[model samples]
Target: MRTSAREVAVTAELNLSQVRALEVLLEEGHFGRAAQRLHVTPSAMTQSINRLERDLGVRLVNRTRHPVVATPAGQRFMHQAVRALEASRAAVEAARGVGAGLLTIGFIDGYSQAESRLLDRFHSENPDVRAEYRQLHWEDQVAALVDGAVDVSFARPPHSGVDTRLLDTRVVTVEPRVAVLAQHSALAQRESLTLDEIDELEVVTSATAPAEWTRWWVIDPRPSGQAVRYGPAVSTIHEAVASVRTAADSGSGHVLITGESVGQRASNAGVVFVPLVDAEPCRIELCTRRSDHRPAVQMLRALADAACSARAKTGRSVQRGAEPGVGVK
Candidate 1:
């Protein structure tokens, strides 16, 4: 009779570390080297092997030999183990490629216009490659890259975990963090304001964004006001923007951090994006996963580099308006 599903489930609950050791042992054919390969002590390796033997109730190796040889059952198991591991690994890779189909890409909302320019070239070159453009907070952009939700991301560093290759970056002036108000607000009078001037205001912010925006950027003494007041909340940048807009419309003075790119957006909305003259200039970076080695990704990277080089060669700033045909789905 075939093994029951429950029995198989019970047996298949193998220790990841032990399975790793078994893989190393099968590959190395020696206990000492297998231990070295696994970066574990020989005693630990022995214990691992012992556990496997106990679990399976079988002798997997001819232990008397200096270089161990798998028993017939052990050999068969090793082959099956290899196939299982490979299949699982492939599955993980494929899952990670979920965003890989069209290179689900993300960009900061403030810089969407500029980003679209760069992406236009990508689409032109790889017409078959799908493109997705979602506005993401800085931290979410990094997280999405790790989970493979977004294939490529643009932001300021340091981008943690994923493999990142730098693209063009510029240090724009640090102005006051702006107050983005709705069409109707009491403090909407001033076209511009400084960070210190608005420090005491109750700011609207997303739980998704980095704390630095509310803490360091806001003028309020209770820098952690957003987190303490609102707690962890917000799934996207759009939600955060909406929150700010709502809070402003409700007569509560709400402020948000903004750079030159975002400053324009806020200004256009009848909101004042104030600048902090003493603040450090914001640094921008183009980031991508280090592990990603796809043809489309590589091509986009090349195009970005070329665009940067062209800008450097001409000693001119690259403008989004100048980007002829960048597209992101």
Candidate 2:
């Protein structure tokens, strides 16, 4: 009869750090990143792997590959390691004894103020579930939630694979989509803008954001349904706002239509946010996976809905023609 490798590992004196390092290494597929994730040097990760292999009495990783892969024995070890790591997290949470544990939440840009209030509300409402926040890009937040890296996502992914059931979503706040033009631009002084008037200007968007979402945000249709002019792509909201500011004073200027929620926070003297009287509202959804309806997640959802209700009281819904092209860009 052959001795079980799991039993051997138990007797071999593997520590938590070594097991965790291996788990991260496997997940990232590289030493440098694994070390970075653990906030340690690559040399430290190397030593951990060395110590683990010596204790296990096997070459657990195939180093011949550019990014390492687990050997057959290593794979078996990893299967057990994952369960062990999860058990450890569960134990730690249990020890915290109610709301003492941390819930990691993620947010993309443009929702800092609303998120701040929501966090305050969460603790006030449920002091036991401590929360932490991370800033992620539009695409990264969706991926993070799918991988279980983030417990809750503050904004629904504007675009993802067609599995609507993947997320349990609640509308937090719906912002009136508004056009921001450089104050010096031809249409800057307008109190409100028509869809046709908006299409005449060069509309700016984050170049890297999903095009479908961006087009919808900027009101890409000219009322006649022709694609409106797209201006230079700004990589971020800050950059987009700065471009509008520059346009207010520069020879070249562009207009941008985005959520009033964020544009309201921006204080650039050169840019102005005017209501898009006839465009669909931009919906901001607080979402968690369908499988992750934990008490903590449910609490956040409830708080978000409360926030939405408050916002609705002060907010006037705005829309004119066909629903905006896509979604939050």
Candidate 3:
């Protein structure tokens, strides 16, 4: 039976969900992982792929492999699928009314002050735009952005070269590093410490965070050419703090290295913060996907820049006043 071109076009048409499922499936290379990324069950992911293949009349995936891979035909279709999704995203953004729709913002620890200031400005300027906030861990920070789970992020620059290539960042603040020690620990009473001085003490590291990030934060190799002693591996700041406190109580002499802002904000009485005067400062940044061009994303970036500039000017003014032989005229 001969079919009209219109009928053929209608028969082969794919919806956004189907395309998205295929995209994530290929990226993740596993049904369960892809389904999890899309917030669907493994069976649903299988069904989605099956439906796509049924509609297109071609086998899209080769399930024989350990990590499933797309067939050649599926690979060819993926290029178009990616372009289609991108165009669809752009169209939706363009079609949205000003101050309408939700914008999800992600933030990591140690940026509460910056996040609050930025949100205050955003709320004032965009009273009608609904905003949602999510806390991100160091391990999944960039992944959340790449997965389209968040519109923007307040984070430190990623230590992994791969992540660095995926994000665009605007430096918002440069904060000095500090050592978090248990209150009873010997280092707790010190006014300040150098990286070399702490190299012998066991440093807490993350279990799932990128190795580069953990290495940089802990100063893996001491300035004196000695290797750092690693202690407990934690997944979150709260856990890290608890580990330090426990170690201190047990006389284990464990430490957590982090930004000064975090140390100032820590409410746990079990820990004390000491400045790492000789270590490099941490750069807090406002980050977003390099390809995201949505209006809300742009607005957040502009507001962040403005807020950072204002803070920088205020810091300079205060520094000028504190300098020897200098005062407000």
lDDT of 2 by residue, 15-104 (tens): 877887887787567899778767899999999999889878999899888778899999988776766655554455445535335687
Stretches of candidate 3 exceeding 4 Å from the true structure: 1-85, 91-100, 159-166, 311-329
65-166: candidate 3 lDDT, tens digit per residue: 877888999988876677666666556645653434677778766465766777788788888778888988786676677666776777664434222444
Span of ten consecutive residues with least summed lDDT in model 2:
316-325
lDDT of 3 at 293: 73
Pick out the ten consecutive residues of candidate 1 with the lowest summed lDDT. 320-329
Clashing pairs for predicted structure model 3, backbone only: none
Between candidates 1 and 3, name the one with more favorable lDDT: 3
lDDT of each: 0.54, 0.70, 0.73
Put the candidates in lDDT order, highest first: 3, 2, 1
TM-score of 3: 0.70
Top-down TM-score ranking = 3, 2, 1
Candidate closest to the true structure, highest lDDT: 3
RMSD of each: 13.9, 7.8, 8.1
Q: Show where candidate 1 strays beyond 4 Å.
A: 1-101, 107-111, 132-139, 158-179, 182-192, 210-251, 263-278, 307-329
lDDT of 1 by residue, 35-85 (tens): 864678999999988887767667778888766778887877766665555
Model 2 has a clash total of 3
